[model samples]
Target: SKITDLEQREKAQYDEITSLKAQRDSMFLDNQASQEKDRDFLKQKISDLETRCKAAESEKSSLKFEIEKEKAKLNYERDHLESIKSEMQETINKLMKKNEQLIA
Candidate 1:
């Protein structure tokens, strides 16, 4: 009778250990799956950010080109105005000289 009791106690302990091992393995698998999902989400987010960065770079390049074109246009306009101002000064001088001669 004592031998039977000892066998039963041993079997109960063995069953409990097996159940604990299975629980531990299940928890480990769940953690691994969670980490994999997080990694995939981060990868997708990084890809989207890279795409947006490329688009912003393209837009900045286009804006720089437009600014350079505007600078060239402004320079050309300033030079043209300078030429007109010089011609007007020459005409004014001529008119003043003719007026002086008439007064004399």
Candidate 2:
């Protein structure tokens, strides 16, 4: 009778161990699924950031081109003004020489 009782207790302990193993397996699967979700979220965030960076680079290039064009226009205007000033100075000198002759 005592041997039979020990055998029953051993069988009960084996069943409990099996149940615990199944519970641990389920928890492991749940953690794996959660990690996959987090990885996907981070990937999408990185892709969005890359797109924004490209758009900003394009806008910066366009602004730089516009600034260069404005600088060229300013240079042309400055050269033209300098030429006009030179011609006016030469005309004044001619007029002064003529006035001196008339007075003499």
Candidate 3:
């Protein structure tokens, strides 16, 4: 009778262990699912960052092109102003020469 009672206790302990193992497995599976979700979230964030970087690079290129065009326009204006100043100097010299001839 004692042997039967001991056997019954052992069977109960074994059933309890099995139940605990199942609970542990369930918790492990839940942790894996949460990790997968985090990984997917990180991947999406990385993709978004890459897209933003490309857009910024494109914008920088466009800004550089605009700056070059503005620089060219400024250079052209400076050259045009220099040419007009030279022509005015030549006209003043000619007028001075005429005045000197009249004085003589």
Give the best candidate by TM-score.
Answer: 3
Write down the TM-score for model 3: 0.89
* TM-score of each model, paired residue for residue: 0.88, 0.76, 0.89
lDDT of 2 by residue, 1-104 (tens): 99999999999989999989999999999999999999999999999999999999999999999999999999999999999999999999999999999999
Query: What C-alpha lDDT, on a 0 to 100 scale, does residue 60 get in candidate 2?
Result: 97
The deviation in Å at residue 58 for candidate 2 is 0.6
By lDDT rank, best first, the candidates go 3, 1, 2
Residue pairs in steric clash, candidate 3? none
lDDT (Cα atoms) of all candidates against the true structure? 0.99, 0.94, 1.00
Worst 10 residues of 2 by lDDT: 10-19
Candidate 1: regions farther than 4 A off: none
Clashing pairs for predicted structure model 2, backbone only: none
Give lDDT tens digits, candidate 3, residues 5-86.
9999999999999999999999999999999999999999999999999999999999999999999999999999999999
Q: TM-score of model 1 relative to the true fold?
A: 0.88
